[model samples]
Target chain A: MSDIVQSLEGLLERLHIDVGLRPILSLVILLAAVFAVICAALWGAVRARWISRNTAAFWIFVSPWIVGFLLFTGGPMVYSLVLSFTNWNLIDPAKFIGIANYKEALSDPDLGQAIKVTLTYAVVSVPLQTVLSLAVALLMNVKVRGIHVFRTIWYLPSLVTGVAQAVLFIWVFNPSYGLANGLLRLFGIEGPKWLFDAHWALATVVIMSLWTVGGNMIIYLAGLQDISKDLYEAAELDGANRWRLLWNITIPQVSPVIFFNVVTGLIYAMQTFTQGYVVTHNGGGPADSLLFYVLYLYQNAFSFFRMGYASALAWIFFVMIMVLTALVFRGSAFWVYYESQRPRERRRRVHVG
Target chain B: MSASAKAPTVKAPTVKAPTAKGAGGPRREPLGGRILAVTLLVVGSIGFVYPFLWMIATALRTPEGVSHGGVSLWPIQWRWSNFTDGLGSFPFWAYLRNSLLSTIVPVVAVVFSSSLVGFAFARIRARGSGVLFAIVLSTLLLPQEVTIVPQFILFKNLDMIDTLWPIIVPTFFGSAFFIFLYRQFYLRLPEAMTDAALIDGAGWFRIWFSIYLPLSRPIIIATAVLQFMSYWNNFFQAAIYLTTDRWKTLPLALAGFQSVNGTNTPLLMATALVVTFPCVLLFFIAQRHIIGGISFTGSK
Candidate 1:
């Protein structure tokens, strides 16, 4: 029996394949061992003697997030970072490629175009959406009869998913069989083939996108609500017209919300994927007019199987957003208003104190 | 253009407004102003609602009735068969069942998991919690495409490809963005209720369930509704992971119908409508939840 056991061990070692139950068990044990180490570290910082009282509560709260971070963020993030240094397809062993992928991505014309289009989309859409949302919110704030119903109706489009909403727009923008054309025909003017015409496609998409301004509108409404009614009443008594009131009281009060929406909206618009994808058959539509930054990254990563290059593109985008956000933050001091901010002369005394 | 710089000028006008209203007892007509306001609202509402109405109209049209020009308020012929034909065209029922499974399970998982994580960040000041939160938030910036390859590789290795596991599993971990939203909401809640629960010998789980869950209904409903729609509208993940026709969700099914066959316009429109119908129905049903959801995250 001893001889047989020795021979079996030798055979398994020679084959390099773990045929015995012990090897498999050991592998499982190794995995558990790693898990235990992580759990122990977390507990030590979270609930152990050295930790603070809220450790367990914090750990317990974060427990659900751990799995997501590990799987979605930690694992994939590290994997992709490593991947950005390699040449790997879906199945192939990743070949070590120095900075070739990074170089290629920088030089890619499609990527350049994508960046331009994405910036244009973000630049145009974010401001437009913000203005429209504020305008609509202002309109809804009035004491019109059945205004609540109108508010609900206006907000309807924003609640619908991007896929459905874009599909609805696509139908309306369909060159041959769309309502847009029909409406144009009513005026004896031919509608430009909106989707298929490269010149008009991106613009049309931007216009279609503006229809769902309701999401930001609701936030503006909340901000509007927070503004004291006394101010508006005061404005009315001072003979301030509607535009003057909107320009003065409303805009200043809601400027912070507008700033928030602008940053978020720009990020969202830059990464506009679903509309570009679904409308253009999983690619940017109509001669790449809708070739959004994230869409291009997606195409490179999944469609073209250029994982490393796509990673580079993603990092570039991340850098761009960071810079843009920082710029916005810096610039915000010039535009955004806080109700707590007193007059400029008063602000000096408060700051000094 | 510091907001404060512009404040004083507007402030003066508003202060004068009430006195003016008293002095001028309903002056002669500002008829032009009222007409302009009415016209703007009417035009805006029409623009907002028209596409949705057109979607309905197109879905109602027969093959012969599908004309680009001459779209009217009413369809020339109401082809109700389009709905029936759409339902009959493919495995529509199966798609719905699959969508329910895909959307509901993941939504429940995301809400439960993200909320739990959110509560930790909001309530507990554990070591590394801030760092961990920052790391998680960073993931929000890494567009989903960046990680799709590795995840696909991981799923392939796990033999979970072609299954709903890909869509369902990640959601169980909790989304960083949603968790952030929930955390902000949780932070704003009064601390007294939590302390009372602790005094009553309620365990963490018990407090979270019995007190926090009930109190956070608005955010919970909003998150759930949003997550439900997220799963429902998910395209690339479904498109990549689900190969078999039986496994297709509504978006994938609808996309397939558009691309695979030639110009069968009526059938295509019908299929698209069916795919979109649930979301629209959901929007109407949960309209109140929508506003609440936006408020929690939109301003922040």
Candidate 2:
């Protein structure tokens, strides 16, 4: 018996040539099996006529994405919701905790601070970005030669990746060996340590947010183009000069675009993460002035392993965005023009039924 | 309904009167008006262009040269090697390849999926399309934070960890904003084209591909450019899904460069410029299509 056990051990040792290759081979086999299953399922879907021929072609073209969304998005969304109700530390059996996660997230002080900072950023950045974009777009709309080049140049910064731009701004706002301070020196003004100072750290982020008006400006330029030349000509005859024209004609015509920008920008700014993540040394800088809501959520999920709490925070964010967007749309009837609205109203009155 | 009935009655008198009178008049730009316009244009242009130029200047300055500039319009030494040195300093080629691979698939996926779904919503009489579309649109309202945790957990269980699936798969779902834009555009297209195609026994996909996609080049280009830029700029997602240095995208690589070469302002600046150049080149190339897309979205 001892000799048989010794021989078996020796054979096992001989078979174990490389430790890494086993896992990799197993993984490949698993993936190949999954691919086969996916192929079979897709073939069934096609053969069943559940999807039309044309639709089949369309789906085929977008098959990679559909699989991705199902696995990555749909699958994750379901799992996350399930996770939010569980007390899984990623190792042990997940315990059902019900609403405890929600309560904890609400009570978390860091979460509150992050929410406050994000709201403040949204309030400041969204309006500033929208107004500035419109202002710049208006200026660019003037019938000046070579203005297209100017428009292109102005938009250059927006095209640059946010990571690179944020990095550049960090240097610009650096107290020492930065251009912002150097510019301040020219005017005999001492520059505050922009990223370091707690009082101004959030403000520094706000300023950075505003600097990327190029994206919004491009959108506003599109809005400007929608303003028919006939409308401007008509306004001119009434002696409505540029300011008056802009106030009455241009503003009203592009009000819908403004609304689009405002709502989307508000949502975007409220969820501001990248700039906040990069600038704040990964924890909101100094005293958490730059702690954005999404950043907080990220910290909870990744850094703290509070997955359940983070999920609760995410749902809260979703609810908030929905409410805010609904409010905007509800109020839009006062300003947003719909060509079909009047006719629909008229048709409603004519309905005998 | 009550508000709408009253609106036209109130504005109808004003709109009609203004429309005719406004059409015949040649706009007269007075000396004061001309000066005001020029001044505003110059100021706006300066505000827009100055920071970018400053960024470029900072990029070209040497470590010592940047310190000496002190708000000077131009760099002192113009350290050209900063660009080469910046490229050499990190796993830039790997990042670029990953970014390129990642960006291309998503762009193609989104364009195809969005158009198909958009056409269904726009022109077809599919049951529950409106409700389905509304659901799709609602996805835009959900912040990325809400989903990230779930997404991460999902990927982990699926053993998609350390893979690009987390970043690439979401693009297949089709963007709510882009789908909405395409839907609006499809609405504006002459309905006769679709009706004729239908009469000829052409399927919905045929009409979409043969008719819609062909005619919508301007918008398609515009959307592709925008998505391309968005994908290029994406950092947070890449930061989360990708951990290994080899798996990093361009934006991640750029951020690493900043963190490492941070003390040398000139080298950092040069790197920033080089990183940004490709996107700038893309924008210039697709400027017309982009402008067209912008106008279309705005007017709607």
Residue B167 lDDT in model 2?
Answer: 75
Candidate 1 CAPRI assessment class: acceptable
Could you tell me every candidate's TM-score relative to the true structure?
0.85, 0.83
iRMS for all predictions?
A: 7.4, 6.9
lDDT of 1 by residue, A215-236 (tens): 8888887667667667777888
Model 1 regions lying over 4 Å from their true place: A1-48, A233-244, A340-347, A350-353, B1-35, B128-142
Q: State in Å the error of residue A95, model 1.
A: 1.2
> Relative to the unseen true structure, what is the C-alpha lDDT of residue A160 in candidate 2, on a scale of 0 to 100?
58
Measured by lDDT, the strongest candidate is: 1
Residue A229, model 2: Cα distance from true site in angstroms? 5.3
| Candidate 2: pairs in clash | A234-B22, B59-B269, B59-B270
Tens-place lDDT digits, model 1, residues B1-300: 122232233311110101112222123225675456556777888878877676777778776677732467576788889888877878888888888999999988988888888877786666788888888787675667656767876666554567777888788778888888878877777666667667777777776766566556667777888888778888878877898987788888777666554255566666766776777787788776666567546655
